[model samples]
Every structure is written in C-alpha cells, then in structure tokens.
Target: MISLLFGAGASFGAELHKPVPPLGNYLFDKLVELGGAFAELPDDIKQEFRLHGFEKGMLSIPNDSRVINPLQKEIAKYLSSFKPSNENAYVRLFRSLREYAKHVNVITLNYDLLIEHAMLMSGAQKVSYGIDANEKSYSVLKVHGSANFVPVLAPNIIFEGNVSIGCGAFIETNQIRSLNSHEEIIKWCDSRQNSDLSPIMCMYNKEKRVVINPKYLESKRKDYTGVISNTRTLIIVGVKYIEHDNHIWDVILDSAPELIIVDPYPSEEFLLLLKQRNITHTLIRDSFYKSVLKLSLHIRSRVKIDPQI
Candidate 1:
C-alpha cells in the first residue's frame, strides 16, 4: 500500500483555473487584489510582510484585532474561487491510485480545495476527509484546516487556554460545520464580508496551530499514523521539510517507510536528513505533472511484477 502527501508547491503547480494560487510569501499581494477585507489592511502591516515574512508579519499583529476575522473570510473567498482543471496531475494521480483506494491515504498541508476538486473530477463518488475513514473510498486529510471547513459554535461553548484569537475573536474546536458543495462554500464566504465570521483555516503562522475540531483532528491524526506507519511506500510531493513542521516529519521518521519525494529541487538539508536517518528513498527531480507520468508507468510495471501490489 502507498500513501501520498502534498504541500503548497503542489497547489502552485496544479492546473487550476486562471490566476493559480500563490505560495505563502506571495499570498498577501494576491489577497490585496481580491479587494474585500484585505483592502482595509494598513500600509504598515503590508510593510511588515515585506520585511519579515508572511507568518511572522501576521504574528506581529495582536490576535484580537478587527482585521483578523474578515482576513480569514477573504482568504476562503479567494481560494474557493479557483476551479481545478479536468485533466491535471492531481486528477491523474487520483486515477492511478483509484484501484488501491482502500489502502491509500492522502495528506495535504494546503488550505485550498484542489485535492477534493481533483478527486471528484477523477470520477470519485465517495471521498473521506479523514474524520470518517471509509475503506471503500479515498481519504484526503487536510492537516492544516481547509477553506471549506467552517466552525460550528454552540451558544454554550466557551473559549479558553491559549486559544488563538488570530483566527477570529473566538475559536471553536468542537464541532465542524462542513459545507457540502462549492456553491454553498462560496455563498458562505460571500455572505459575511464585514461580519465577524471566520473559516476554520489555520492561516500562515510559524506556530502552526490546527483550528480543526478536536474530534476530527484526533481521527485524522490516527489515520495518518496508521497509514504512514504500515504503508509500503510514502509519496511526498512538492513539500519542504521545515523545522516547525516536526509534528509531521517526526512521524515519518518513526515509521520509516520507503520515501519517494517529487520536487524539482530537493533541499540539501532534506537530503542530508534522509541520509542521516538511513532510510530507503528515491528522489524524483522533476515537476508534479512529469513526475506523475513517471509514477504511473512505475506503478504499472510494479503491478505487472506483483499483481497484488
């Protein structure tokens, strides 16, 4: 069995509709163009972004600021605007893994719906988003909260203990209110332009806090642990192994699966880490689309050698 992991680079390379999503550093400029809450952002804040970085710049602002809620809403609106092309690497990869759907798991660090969109476009009728693992369907785990994931706050719910007001005035980690369709998600995003509503996304932050519901978070983590620990191969695409993401990397290290990383330029630190760990891995120095073609052929050849694979 094999599982897949994706990062922001995967989305940047994906063939989505015109004006593809930008990486973290370039995100602020894109949001500015969208012209909702971002338009209200102060010039000094923009300057801070230019100097330090997106995450650190965001952290510099107080959590309870007026801009945070609407900022998250605009993020959802902008990301949800893009539609995945019918025949992209994302769709092709899903097609390749369709036969092994039961045994495969997909984990992504992106906030966009590209993976979900690709799965549906690939003729998938049932897709699980890690909370409810379906052996009969593909499991796409969004480690960082997704654009479509909305928080459902009960009146009785109380916020406490290092809760991030950066996400919103209040954080709801209990029940997740998932928008079923793209139209519904768009409507939700557009509904509250100036309202105090926020999506369940953990925005660009160096701290990497997960805003997903506790129940859902636990289930997804379990699924991730189970799949990564026992899978024959782990395919990582366009992901940078940074120190802050040790929660993710540490698990891979402990499991020690056969790693197959697809990145045009693999960082020296990442390569060194792989060598130091003494784990078996293959580095595919290429883009996502070209790498998918190679992977498809490789899967075909492997299946021919061992039919059960």
Candidate 2:
C-alpha cells in the first residue's frame, strides 16, 4: 500500500492566488493581516512568536486566555478562503493515485480543505475520514484536525463545589460525520452571535492538546497507525520533520517504509535524522508543484511498463 503525508508547505504550493498561506513562522503575520482580535495582541506576544515557533509561543500563553478563541476562529476563516486551482499539484497527484485508489491512504497535517477539493477534481467518488467510508471513497485523515472541525460547547452543567466546576466544550465526531456540505461550514463560521462553536486548528505543542474531545483525536491516531504500518511507499510532500512532532516521526520510524520526500530545499537536520535511523529515502529537490508533476509522469510510465501494477 502507498501512503501520502502533507504539511503546511503542501498547502502553500496549492494556493490558487497570492498571499499563499504563511508557514508556521509567519503565522503571526497572517493573523495580523486578518486584523481585529489579532491586531490587539501585545508586542511581547508577537515577539515571542518570532523568537520561538508557533507551537512553543502558543504554549507560553495561558490555555484559558481570551485571545485563544478569536485566534482559532480567525485562522479557520483565513484558511477556508484558500482555494486550489483546478489543475494544481494535489489534483495531479490524486489523478496518479486514482488507479491505486483502494491501496492508497492520505494523511495531512494541514487545516485547509485543498486536498478534498483536489481529490474531487481528480474524479474521486468521495473523501472519507478515518474508518468511515464507501467502497469508492478515499481516506483523507487529518491528524492535526481541520478548518471545519468546530468544537461544540456543552451547556452549563456545574457541580456544587467551592469553585463552580462546569462541563467544558467538546467536539462531536458525529457532527463531523454529518458535515457533508459547504453550507454547514459557513453556518459554523458565520454565526457571529453564537459563541458555542470554535475552529479546531493545527497543532500548537508536543502534548497534542486541544480543547476538543479526546475520542476524536484517538480515532485519528489509530487510523494513522493502521495506514503507516501497511505503507510500502510513503510519499511526503512539503513536511518539516520538527522535534515538536516526534509523535508523527515515531510512527514513520517504526514502520520504516521507503520514503519519497519532496521539497525545494531539504533540511540538513532531516537528512541527518534519516541517515541516523538507517532508513532509505529519496529527496526530490524541487517545489511540490514541479515534483508532483514528475511523480505523476513516473506513475504513468510504471503503469505503461506493467499494466498489472
């Protein structure tokens, strides 16, 4: 089986227009561009983001800060606006994988829905998350949650204590199962008066903590392991192998599949890590846009040589 993993770089390459979503380092800038709540953030907070990365910087702040809610919501709103061109790299890659539909599994750490859009454009029947599927569907697992995965706040159910203990908000996985339309996402984001919902953005720390329900996260992890374990060829596009994401790295190292990493400039640290692990991998020193085209051609050539493959 073949598995595909994508990161922020993949989304950046798939942008249909200018101001391609900034990477983690430039996140604060993007948030600033959005103005409103983000604009009100103190200079120290912005400096912290610049000094440390997004995850570490976010972790420095208290979890219950008022800014957290608006931060998550604005991020979702900004990312939702990103649309991939009809014939983008993701579409080309999906088209190449069409022949091996059942044997393929896709996992993305990005919050954008570009993958879904591209899959549809590539003639995929449906996009399934985790274990849920139809025979024609392709599994598109989002390990770092998604722009559409909104947390639903539970009603006030406080226990009688010295300090009012109340039930916290949680994500309804069932709600995600039923979110089959763009209208549903619009409703969630556009509900200005309703503070009951908030977007579940990407990872901000090593603990993998989020305000949403834990079951949903567990489901994603289980599905990720199942895919990686069986992956013969793991095609990674635009992902940075950072220390904070060791959980993801642990699975890849344990599986130790043949790796194909696509990026313009592969990091030396990443190359060294792969070497230290004694895992065989190919580095495609090109942008995802160009690399995916090459990948598609390679796939086509292989099929022509042996149709049975």
Candidate 3:
C-alpha cells in the first residue's frame, strides 16, 4: 500500500492559463487586491493578520458565516478558474499511479478535481472521490473540500465535517466523462455550482461545516495513518508541511515512512525537523515532472501495464 500526499503545489505545473491562488498567508496580498469580504476584513481579523501573519491569523478569525460564506464562494471560484491541457503532467502522474502502486491512496489539501480528472483519464475506471461505493478502487481523500463537492439538505446522508448551509442551496457531483477536456470540466463545474443560485462547496477548517461525504473523509484519514505506519516509502509532493498540518506531521513523524519530498524549494523548518528526528529522507529539489523523470527508470522497471485496456 503506497500513499501520495499532495498539496496545492502538486497541480501547479498542470494548471491552465493562471496559477492557483497560493495557500497560507501568500494569498493575503491577492485577497486584499481582490477585495470584498477578503479585502475588507473586520478590525480584529485585520489586526491578527498584522500581528501574526496569514496562516495563524486566519486560524484566529472565527469560521462563521461572515467569513466562511464569502470565502467559500471566492475560493471555489479561484480553484476552478484554471484548466489543465493534454500536456499536463498530472495526466502522466495519474497514469503512473494506476500502473505502479498496487493500492493507491491520495491525501490532498487541494480543492481542485485535477487528481480525480487525472485518475479518470488514466484509465482508472473505478475511482472513488471519498463518496459512494468505491470498493477496490483508487481512493482520493480530499483533506480539504473540493470545488465539486456541494452542500445538501438531504437527510440520511453522511457528510465530512459539519457546516450550516443555506437549506435551499444543495447539489451533488456526478460521474463526468473520463476524457473530458478542461473546457468540458469547467462547464460541468459551473453548471453544478450554479453560481450565486446555489451555495455549495466546502472550505478547509479544523471543524468545517460544509458538504462532503463522512465515509470518504473517515476512510482517508484511517487509511493514510495506517499506510504511513506500514509502507517503507512515502512520496510527499508539493507540500510545505505548515503549522495547520501539525497533526499530519505527528503521524508522518511517528510512523516515519522513508520520505521522498518533491518541492522546488524545500521547507527549512521541515528539513530541520527531519534531521532532529533522524528520519531518513530524500529531497528532490525539482519540479514534479522533472522529479518523475528522475525516477522514470526506477518506475519503468517496477510498473506493469494495466491489463484492463
């Protein structure tokens, strides 16, 4: 069982037109410029940003309707703004995942559906997006709620985290075509989201009150924790190992899977932590595609073609 933990940077190379809005405090300037709820922060929230910085400052502010409502809409819009071309590395990455890893589990902090699209495109026929019946299929645990995941008022449905959504505005994701282009996906997403007509999508918070499948979230955490504990090797791509993710760090450190970190600029704090902990790790100081190219020979020898085709 192998696990690939992804962050926002994981899909950076695959995005179309523009780059994704940065996670943590890097978006403070952008959010400020974008204005509206993000720009005109309340006095207390603004003070937190001034004092601590974006990451910690966000944590300080309450995740109430005032902040979360506006923020979710904006975030969803921002995440869905990009398109991945055929040449996108994610296509190759997911194909590799399908062929190489016997049991693949993805834990991601991104709200985009790039992984899902890639999995679908890579001929991974039965892919599970943390919902419905995904038995024996590739499991994608979206640590953060996805742009496609929408709030619903339906009863008897289990959801990941909890949020007080507008009772009237609820929607669900569908089985989109595997070869759907970025344009098709964007159109599909916009239709599903329904803009201001519907208030769906979940944002990341310790205790989020939004729409997502509880079954999906529960399985992801459990599987990731177990996989990290047992697997000899773990590949962490495009992640910064930030403070909000201290809990994940606890497990990764405790379990201590042989770490392969792929980032253009690796985190010094994380590297220091690895040293102090004496964790044997490899740092690939390159973009995701180059890193994959670096390991292509090893991968080629290990992976077998999918017989499903």
> Local distance difference test, per candidate?
0.71, 0.69, 0.59
Worst 10 residues of 1 by lDDT: 157-166
| Candidate 1 vs 3: which has more lDDT | 1
Residue 93 C-alpha lDDT in model 2: 82
Compare candidates 1 and 2 on lDDT and give the better one: 1
Q: Regarding lDDT, does 2 or 3 come out ahead?
A: 2
Question: Which residue pairs in model 1 clash with each other?
Answer: none
Q: Give the C-alpha lDDT of model 2.
A: 0.69
Ranking by lDDT: 1, 2, 3
What TM-score does each of the candidates earn? 0.85, 0.84, 0.70
Model 1 stretches astray by more than 4 angstroms = 16-18, 131-136, 153-169, 192-194, 210-219, 298-309
lDDT of each residue in 1-309, candidate 2, tens digit only: 667789888877764454466788887777787676667778887777779877777766555424555567677767766666755788878877676666556889887778887877778788877634333676688987887776544445221111211323333434443244455666765675335345665446656666554567667777788888887778888898876676688889888998889888777987898899999898888878778767665445433333433
- State the RMSD for candidate 1: 4.1
Q: 1-309, model 3: which lDDT tens digit per residue?
A: 446788867777444453654655565666666675677777777777667766556666563443555566555555655555555567667665555535445677677767776666666666665423232356576655566554433445443233444432233333211213444434543452333322343334443434333444444566556656776667788887765555467789988877878898888999998999999888888877566654443344333454341
Winner on TM-score between 2 and 3 is: 2
